[model samples]
Target: MATAKLKMSEVRGDVAVGVAQGGATVHALKLEGGKNVPLCPTRPKNGLRHMGLAHEQKPDLELCMKCSAIVPTGPVTVTKEQVSIPGLDRTVIRKVVRPVNDTDTTTEEEEAPVMAENTTTADPRDAQVEEIRASIERLPSLLEADNAEGAEELNGEIETAIAGLGGKGVAALRKTLRAERDKALAAGEEAKAAKTPSAEIVNLETKELDDNGKALIQKGIDKVKELAVNKFQGGHAIAEIVLDIRLGITTKNGYPDISADTDLGKKVGGALIFDDILAGLPEEGEDEASDAIRAEIGSIKKSARNAMQDVKVRYVRSLDNSPEEAKKFGYALEAHPDKKPSEAVFTFHGIQSLTRAEQAKQARELKAAEKEKTRLAIEAGELSEEEAEALSSDGEKSEKEKRTETSNKLKKTALKLISDVKGIEDEEEKDEALEALTVLFADLRKALTAK
Candidate 1:
C-alpha cells in the first residue's frame, strides 16, 4: 500500500484524488484509514488522463470493474496518529486540522448560564480557500482587461493561498487559470499576425482544436522557430542541423511534443562545427575563429542558463511577447545545411550533454588530486603507508583494499610479460605471445567466476 497525498474535494462532496509518490503518475483512492488502493489493477488502455476533482471533471473516473466491494458502513475513529505504510520508502501525509463541529444538543434551560468566554473560531484555512476561489473567478476578467501585472499579482496570491491550503479544487483552478492566460496571450499574438516567410512552417494537425487552442499552438511553434533562428550561429553550430520542425500537439493538454530532423557530425558539409572550432589552435591558432567560437559558446551557455531560470518562474511570461520560455523548451539550430540532410532525428540534449561531461571531468580531476595529495603525504613521512591505507578503508577488510590488491597484481604480471616480450625482435612472435597471455587471463577469469 503506497502512502498517498490525498485531498478532499472542494467542488464536490465525498470525492478525492490520491496522488501517489513515484516516477510515474497513478490513479488510486485514499481510504478513510489512509491506505491507498489502485482504482484498477490494470491501467487504462488509453492511459491515465487527468482525473482532477473539480468542475468539468473528466468522465473517465469510473471504476474498471463493476464488481461488488466492501466499504466502512459505520462511523470510524479518525486520529492523527502516524501509521507506516509498508514497501513505500518514504511517506508524507499532510496533517489537515479541520474545524471541530459544535455538538451542543442541550436545551436553553440546561445550557450553562455562564461560560468562560467561548474562544472557538473558524479555521483560517477556510477563509483562505474562499479567497482563492474569489481570485480564480476574477482571473478571466483580469486577462480581458490586459492587466498583465495585476494578473501576475493575483496569480502569485492564488499560488500562496493554495500552498497554504492545498486541495484538488485549488489545483484545478490554477490549471484552468494557466490555460486562460496561455489562450489570452496566444490571441494577442494572432491578432498582430506577424507572419514570417523565412521561418520553417510547423506541420501539425490542430484542426480538431478550437480557435484559441490553435492560436496557442501556433504561438508556441512561432516561438520555437524564432528561437532556432536566434540561437543559430553558422561557424560554431553543433550536431543538430534543423531541416524541419514537427509538433504533435495534445488537444487534451496543449503542450507540444517538439522534435526535429537533424544531421549529426563534427562538420556538416564543409562548415566548421562546434568541436572543430573548439580544437582551433592546431590549424587556426589564437585567431578570429577561436575568439568567435569562445564568444558563441559563452552566449549559448548564458541563454541555456536563462532558459532554466524561466522554468523556476513557472514558464509563463510576465509580458506576452517574451521568448525566454519558448527558448527554454526548444532545440538548438544550425545555419549551414547538412550534406546529408535529415539523416537522423534529434531531441533536446545538446547543452545538457556538454554540461554533464564537464561535471564528470571535474569529478575525475578532484578524485585524482585527492589521490596525489595522499601519495605526497606518504612520501613526506607526514603520513605512513599503513595509516594512509587505514584512512582509505571502511573496516578491517574493505572492498577498496581488495580491488587495489587485485589491480596491482594484474599490473605487475602484465609488466613482467611485456618486458619478456620486448626482448623478442620479431614483431609477429611478440604479438602472438601477448595474444596468448590475453587468452590465458580471460580463461582464468571465466574459471574463477564459473560458480
Candidate 2:
C-alpha cells in the first residue's frame, strides 16, 4: 500500500491567520479533510506561496479567494512618534521614526506638540514638580466648588509627586495649600454662622402668684416634705429641696417647691421668698434682689452639689425631653411665687438617694446573688470548687475569668427568675414575667460575653 499525497488545490474551507509555535506569523489553509496546512513566508523576500499564487510580497495584504484581490488586514495610516522633555523655561520635543510592525504605541502625544529649547534636557522630576504645582493651585477652586473628594485625591497625588523633592519650593507650596484649605473652612463656618440664629435667654421679672400658682407651689412643698420624711435625714433639708426640684416635682401651679421645715430650709426659703418678691416687685429699674437671685440659685446649686458627693441620686426623665429645662426651672423657682398660677405649672420628679442601711442591704443582696451563681455553676458541673474559689478570691483575675463569673451569675439569675414565674397564680402575670425575664437574660448574656 502506498501513502496518499496532499494537494493544496484539494483544500476546501476558509483560510485563517495565526502565529506559529516559534512566534512566526503564518497563514493556515483549512482542508476538506479537516486538517490545517500552515504556510510560512519565505525569508529575505518576505513572500508567501499558497493555492498556486507565488511570491506575494506585502505582509499586511491578504489575498481574497473569491475576487482574487489583495486587501489590507490592519490599520492603514502611519502615526509619527514624539518625545517631550519638561524644562524650567519651555518644554523640549523630538520626533523619532517607528516601524509599522512595532505594535507598541505607549508614548502619548501632546495636544499641541512644540519644538524643544536648545539649552534644556528632559528631566522627569521637573515634570512631576510642575504637575504637582498645577494640582496644588487647583485645590482651592475644587474646595470652593465642594468637590472635596476630588480635592483630596489631587492632594494625595501632589504629595506623592513632591515626596522626593526638597528645599523651600515644596515647603512654600505646602504652606499655600494649607492656607487655601483654612480659608475655605473659615468661609464655610462664616456662611453657617450667617444662617444660624443666636439664642437669647431673658431673665424676666417675677410676678405675684395667683390662687392656682399658690396651690401648685403648696403641692410641690407637700411632695418635698413627704420625700424628706420618708428618705432624708433632718439635716438634709436643703439637699432634699434641691433633689425634689431636680426631679421635676413642681407644684400644681408649675413652680418648683423650695419649702422645707428645717432651720436651714427656713433660711433658704426666706432668701427664695425675698428673691421672688424682688423679682415680682415691679422691676422699677433693676432691683438688687433681681440680681441677687443669681447668687441665690448659685448658692443652692452649690449646696446640692455637695450633697450629691455622698449620695447617688438618679433623675429620670422622658427620653425626648431635655434635662436642662428642669434645671432652668429650678433656677427660676423663686420667680415662680410671683408669676401667675398658670405660668408656674411645671413637672419635676426625683428618686431619693440610698441611705447607709439601704446601701448595706443592696450589698448583701449582691453577695447573695454571687453566692447563688457560684452554687448553680457548681451544681451544673460547669465550674469546679477550686475555680470558683479562685474567682471569688481577693487576687486579681483575668478578664476572661471575670466574664465567666458574670455569665454564671446571669445564668443563675435567669434560672431563678424562670422558676419564680411558675409560682405566679395569674396566667397573664406569669406570661408577662417570663417574657420580661427572657429579654433580660438575653441582654445580660450578651453583655457578659461582649468584646
Candidate 3:
C-alpha cells in the first residue's frame, strides 16, 4: 500500500509529490526516458488539494491519522503557545527583507526622468559618451597593432582626427600650401613644378591636359609637404600640429619652434613654450642673425604660423559647453597639458547630440550579422548575390524544406513563451511573448540571407 499526504492546491492541474517508506521518493517513473522533468499531476480527484514533496510528505514524519491540516509551505513562524517544550525559546526575527530599496525613489522634480528630446540639450558626459571617446581614441592603437591589414584601418582614424580639429589649424595649413604653390608659380613664369609625375599623391591619370598636351602632374611640393609629420609640407598644417602634440613636442602656442635656443631655454623653455608659441615666433628673429638663410628660415616659420592664424580670422568657435562644462574642460586640458584639445563649437545648449551607446553597438552588430549571413550564404550556395536585402516582417519565404523548418521553429518558440508563465495574467504574458518574438525575429532575419 502506498502512503502520501494530501496538501492544498489551486485547480484541476495539481502536483502530487511524496515518498513511500525507507526515505524513497517515487514520482512519475521513467517511461523510456531517464527522468520525469515535472511533478506528477495524477492525484486524488479533488479540485482544491494536492501533496507537496516537502515536510508534508516527509516519509518518516507522521501525523495523527484523523487530523486534517493546512500548513504554510513557504515560510515558517512559531507562536509563544507552541513553545511549551521546556526551555525552547520561540523568538523569531519577523522582518521581511526586501530585495530592492523602496525608499530610494527620487523625489526631485528637476531630476525627473528625461526623454530623448531633453537629453539632446544635456551634456555629453551625462549621456554614455565616455566609452565612445575611449573607443575612438583606442582605434589608432588597434590599427597600429593590426599593421598587416591590406588597407590599414588607422587611415580612417587618422583622417577623422585630422578632420575633428576644425579650427585655425586647417586654415593655416591651407595658406601654407597656397603660398608654396604661388612661390612654385613664381619660380617658373608658367612652368609648374614637374607636372603630374612630380607628385606622389597627385594622380597623373586624373590630370587635366594643358594646351601643350602635357599632363600637369605636379600638384606641387606643398602636397608632399603635408605628408611631413615630423615637420610638415602636407596640405594641412593643423594635422602637423596635432601630430607634433601627439609626439610629445613642446608646443608653446601652436607652431613648432624649430629655431635654435640655449640649453637653458630648451630645459626651462619647455615649461614656458605652450603659453606663447606664436607670440615667441615673430619676436625672436628681431634680435637674431640678419643673414639670408636666417631670413629664409624666418619667412618659412612666419608662413607656417600664418597658416593657423588664418583659420581664426574666419571662424571662431567657443570651446566649452555649459559654464560648468567649460570650467571642467579647461581644468582637464590644463591638467593634461600634453593632450590634444577638441575644437567643438560651444553651442549655448550642450554637446548638441543625443545617441545611446547601444545604437553604435547595434550598428556594429548589424554589420557583423550581415557579413556573417553573406559568408554563410556563400558556403551554402543558396544565393547568387553576396548582399542580402532588408526584409519585410511578412516576407514571401519560398522553399518547402525551409518553410517546414521555419514553421517548426516558430511553433517551438510559441510553446516556450506559453510555458514560461503557467496560467498567469494574459496581458503580462502577451507582452513578454511579444518582446521575445521581436528579439528572435531580428536575430533570425539577420542570419537568413535574401535567397
Candidate 4:
C-alpha cells in the first residue's frame, strides 16, 4: 500500500516532474539491446512553468516535459520540492526564505547566496486554499478597506486590521482575486489578461545569472582537489579542468612583457611569455603521444570558440538623439518612409549550449579523476613535504623534472600563489586569482598524490 503519493524525484534521480513519495517503485526500464534509456514518465499538465529544473540538470534525465490536456492543475504547480500558485493580477505566491533584520541593506561587497535547487516543497495549491480560507474569514475588514480607498482615517484602521496577518493575509486577498480571474478565464470573459503577466510582456528586467565559474567556485574549491586527481582512459574533460588549472596557476604579476616605447618609457606593453598552453605536456616521452593529442584538442576547442565570436556578436542600435542624428533619421513624417525601427535585444543561446556541452566534459573529467586516483594509488606511497617543496620550482629552476616535471611545478606554483595572495591589497582581484591557482595546484596534485 502506498502511504503517500510518490514524485519523480522520489522514484529515481532521473525523473524530475510527476511522481511523489511512498508510491510504487519505478521499475528499471531497458531497451532491446539492454542499455538503460532515459524515460520521462507521464506528468499531469500544469500551467505554471518552473525553471524546469530543481538543480543543475542530471546526466540521466530529460529535464523538460510536454503534457497535453491539463484541465486545471488544482492551483498547485509542483516541481520537485518547489511550488507556486497564481494570485491576483496574475501574480504568483510561493514559499521563500523570509530574511530577518533588513535584507535589502546588503552592500555590493557582500556576495549573494548561491541559488538552491528545490530540495523539497509543498504544493502551491495549499497556499491558495489557505489564502482563500483566510480571506473568507476576514471579509468584513477587507471589504472595509476596499470601501475606504482614499479615506486616510479608514485606511489606518484597515492597515491595523491586516497588520497582524502579514504576508499570508495579503496573499489570501490575492488568492481570492486569482480565483475570480481563473473563473473569468474558464468563462472566456477576460481572455486577453488570462495569459498572465509573463506572456504579454514585450520585455522584463531580469537578473543576469552568474556564469558557471562563479556559480561553481566555492563548490569547486571544496570538491576540485579530490576530483582533478582522477584519470579516466577515454575522458576528454581533462582539458577543461586543465584550462581551469592554467587559469589558477597564472599569477597576477603582469605577464612578462616586451614594452614598445617612443622616446619615453615603456608604452604599449604586450605579453612576452609564449602561450603556456600545451605546457602541461609531460616533457619527455618515448611516444610523444599526449603532447600531440593535447595540442590538437586545445587548438580545436580554441578554434571553435573563435569561430563563434563573430557569429555571436549582434549589434544593438546606438542611442541617438542629436540634431544630426534626427536629420538622418528623417524627423518629419513625410521625410522618413521607413517604419520606426524596433529595439535589438541581442541574445545568444551559445552560453546555454556551451554549458550543456561542458556538462558532458565534466562527466568525463570525473571519470578520468576516478581512474587517475586508482593509478596514483599504485605509483606513489604519498608525497612527502620535502618532495612537495622540491617540486615547487619557478622560472629556470623548476624545469628539471622528468617529462612530468611541469605538471608538478604547476601544482607547486598554485600553492605558492594561494599563500602569496593573502597579503595583496586588493581583495577582489586576489580572490579570483587565488581561486584559479587553487584549481590548478589541486589538479596537479592529483597526478602526484599517489606517488
Candidate 5:
C-alpha cells in the first residue's frame, strides 16, 4: 500500500495549484491556462480556494486526502509534535515525531539570485611583451659571461622579437654578437695605405706602351680633371676612369676580319657610360698600331685613376639622403651632427640655409618647452627634482637614435594594421580600409605631436 495525504502547491498569477475542488486532497501540480490536465484534472479555482483559505473555512481540510496518489514522490521532513501515543494511555499528551511534506511556498528566484560581473581581467599579451623585454635585458650579462651558446640563442630570440615588432634600423643591436664572432675571425681587408702599389710598378707597366700610349694616358688624366672640375668644382673623392679596347681574330669567312674596336667609358657614381667624352677615341685596326693604341688607352685609364686618388678634397654629407654626386668631389660623406638623419640636404664648407635656421629655431623652442614643463612639474609636486633631471638626461639621446625609435614604432603599428587589413578577402574593401587607417594614423600622429 502507498501513503495518501494532501499536497498543497503555491499559487502564482491567475493560476491555482494543488487544490482539488469538491475533494479534500490536492496534488502538487498546476493546470495550464485554467484547463484540465489529465495528470490532475481537479485543480483549485483561480486565486479563490487554496489550502490556507480552505482550512480557515473548514478545519477538517487538514485531514483531506484526495489528490495524494498522483503527487510527485520526494523527500519528506520529520518534526516532533504533541500528540496522543497509539496503544498507550488514552488522551496522553506525549511528544511524537511525525513525517511532514514540504509545505513552505517560496519561488526559485527567492532562493538564489544572479551575481554582478567582475571587472578585472589580465591581458596576456602585455605579459608576453614584458617577458621578451626581460630576455633582452639579460643580453649584456650573457655577453659578459662569455656564454657563446646562450648569447647565440638569445640573439635568435631577439631577432625574432624584432621581426615581430617590424624590424628596421636594429643593426646596432647585433654589435655584441658581431664582437663575439670577431674573436675567431680575422679581417680580410688590408689597410688602404698598405694596399697601394709602388710607383715603380706603374712606371714599368707604362714602359710597355709607346709615345702614343703615354699621350693617351695624359689625355685620359686631363679628361678626368676636366670632368671633375665641371661636375664637382675640383673635387675628386670618388670618381673613376674606365677604358675598353676590343679585337677580333682572322676573318676566314671573308667578313672584313674585324679587330681592335677602341672604346672608352666615363665612369661616374659607379656607373660606366660611353655617352661622355670617352665615347670614341682610338681608330679601329688589327695591326700593330691597334695593339699599341689599346696599350696606350690602358695606361691613360690607370694614370687617371691614380690622379683621382691624389686629388685630396674632404667633403661631408649634410644628411644621409644627400646626393651621391656630392661624394665624388671631395665632400664629406658623413651626415652633419646638427642635421636630422632623414633630412636630404647636402652642404659643403659649413654652409647653412634658411630652412636650417628655421629648424634650429624650432629645436630650441622644443627644448625650452620641455625644460619648462619639467620645471613646472617639479614645482607643482608632480615630480621630484631627481626624477625630472633623470628624464632630462634620458632626452639627451642623439637625434638619429630618437628618430630611429619613432620610425620603428610607426613601422610596428603600420605592420599590425597591414596584417589586419590583409585578412579582408575583398581587395577593394581592403584597399579602402587601409587608406582610411593611414589617414586616421596621420591625424592621430598630428594630434599627439602637437604642442
Candidate 6:
C-alpha cells in the first residue's frame, strides 16, 4: 500500500493536484492540510518544476523527504553545456538539471562539449618576460646618469632574463646598448687624437748647459788634472786639494783675483776663474771627463783614509837613545827624562806584532812598579799593612789572573819569534827558531805557575 512516486515533469494535467493561487505550479502536497507551496524550477533537488524559469538561478533549499510531506520520485537528468564569455577565449561549463520518468534506478552523467583553444589563462613565461622588460627599461636611465657600474650590473640581469626567454625579446634595447658603446669608443679615440703634444720638462737643478759653459768646464778639468800631476805627484786625490787651492785664490765675493800682476798669481787666477765657471754649470750637462776625474779623486781619498786607519803603531825601547828611532818609526818621540836608557821609548808604525809585544811588556812593568810602591808605602806607614798585603799576591794567585799573565808573556815571546822569523829568509833556520821559542814558552808557563 505504498503511494506511487512521480516526477513534476511526468505528472499529467488530468491528475488531481492542488495548485497555489496566481497560477503557481505545485511542487509538493501538504499532507497535513496547509497551503500548496509554489515550485522553483531552478531547484531540481527541491523536486520543483517551472518550464520558463531562468537556468542561471541556484537552488534555495536542500531537498529531503523529512522536510516535504510529498516527495517527488523520478530520474535526475544532468546536461553539461559550454557557455562562452564575450571577451575570454575559453568557455565555462553550465550544468542543467531536468526531472525525467524513472524506468530504472541508476544515476547518469553527461560529457561537456569541447572548448576552443585561447590564451585567456596566464602563461608561465609571462612573468619572466615582464622582469626582463623592466630591467631593460631601467638600463637607459642608468646609462644617462653615467652610472657605468650600475648600468653594467642591470644589463647583466636583463641579459640573463632575456637569455632565459631564449633571446627572443629585447632586440631594440640590445641595439641601443651596442650603439652607445660604439659611440663611447669613438669619442675616446677622438679625444686622444685631438690631444696636444707636451714639451719635455727640464729640472731646475739639472738643466742642460750652453756651449760657453761646456768650454769653461773642460778647461777647469784640465787644470785639476795638471795640479794632481804636479803638486800631489798623482799620489793623492785632487778634488779636496783643488777645492782648497781654488778657494784660496778666490776673494770673499767668490770671484777669482784677476787683478794680480805676478805670473803665479795669474796662473792661480785663471785656474780659479775656470773652476768657478765649471761649478756654476748645471749638473745634468756636466762632461764625462769631469765626472770621471771627480770619481777617481773620491776613490783615492777613501783608499788613503782606509790605509791610515789600518796603519798599526807600536812603542819599543830605543836601542841608541837617539831621535833616529822617531824618524824611522814615522812618529814624533815623546821625552821621558825619568826613565833609564833601556826604558827610553821608540815607535814602530805599521807593525802589529811589535806593537802587541811592546804593550805587554809595558803592562808587566807597570804591575811590578805598583807592587814595589805598595811595599814602600807600608814601610813608611803611609799605607796600612793590610792594604799592602791586599796589593801583593798571596803564595797562590787566582787561576784566572795567573793564566792571563802567562798568556801575555807567551804572546810577547811568540811576537818576538815571529819578527825574527820574518827577518830570516832561510826556511830551515826559521823552523828551528820557532821550535826553540815553543820550548821557551813551555818553561815560562811552568815558572809562572811555580811563582
Question: Considering every candidate listed, which one attains the maximal lDDT?
Answer: 2
TM-score of each: 0.16, 0.23, 0.17, 0.15, 0.15, 0.15
lDDT of 6 by residue, 1-451 (tens): 3333343344321111322222233333221211122322222212212221122222342222221234433334556566543323455664444544455464433321111101233222344445555565566555655566887786665544443331112344345444544455455445544452444432335577899999999999999999655544332333334323432464444333222234444454344544555565556436777666544544454443333212222123433454553333222223445543324332112123344346678878887887788888888999996556545643455556677899899789879867977688643334445655566668878997995
Task: Estimate the TM-score for candidate 6.
Answer: 0.15
Compared with the true structure, all predictions reach lDDT values of 0.41, 0.45, 0.35, 0.35, 0.40, 0.43
Residue 70 displacement in candidate 6 (angstroms): 82
- Minimum summed lDDT over a 10-residue window in model 1 is located at 66-75
Model 1, 90-207: lDDT tens digits are: 4334222222224646553553221111112222234444555667667656656666688778777666544443332344445644565456556544443454233345445354
RMSD of 2: 27.1
> Over the stretch 1-451, how does candidate 4's per-residue lDDT look in tens digits?
3133232232322122321111111222212121112132322121111212222223343222211111111111233222333343344433333112245476523523212212233323334345444543343343334433433343343333333222223556644654543343333323433444674364664445468757788787868765543322112343333222332232234211111112111111111111344455566464479666664654444443333322222111221323343332232322333423112112111122233345578877876775566456545866544454344322133323554677688668857766788868643334445655566567767987867
What ranges in model 3 sit over 4 Å off? 1-127, 147-410, 421-433, 442-449
lDDT by residue (1-451, candidate 3, tens digit) is 3323333221111112322211222232111121112133322121111123222244443321111122212222222211111112233222111112235574434332221111113321222223223334444333334332421343343333333221112344334333443343344422323342445575546655775444334544555655454243332354235323432433454322222123433433233433344444545456554343344544445444434333321222323333542442453456545643333222211222322344467767887776677667767987654123323122434355467888899899878866664445543234434545566667778888646
Worst 10-residue stretch by lDDT in candidate 5?
112-121
Worst 10 residues of 3 by lDDT: 78-87
Q: Candidate 1, clashing residue pairs? A: none
Number of the predicted model whose TM-score against the real structure is largest: 2
Off by over 4 Å in 6: 1-287, 311-322, 325-451
Candidate 2 structure quality by residue, lDDT tens digits, 1-451? 3222222232221223222222222333222222223332212122222221111223443332311212112222223234343323223233221212345544424211111111123322344456556666676666666666886787676654444332213445455445554565566545555554554422343468889999999999999999656443432555655555433444455544333334444445345544565556544446776566554555545545445423323222221154454454543434566642223322222334454466779878887888799999999999998788777633578567788999899779868878888899744345445655666668877997999
Q: Which sections of candidate 2 miss by over 4 Å?
A: 1-78, 81-83, 87-131, 134-157, 160-235, 239-357, 360-380, 383-451
Error of 4 at 148 (Å): 66
C-alpha lDDT (0 to 100) for residue 102 of candidate 2: 40
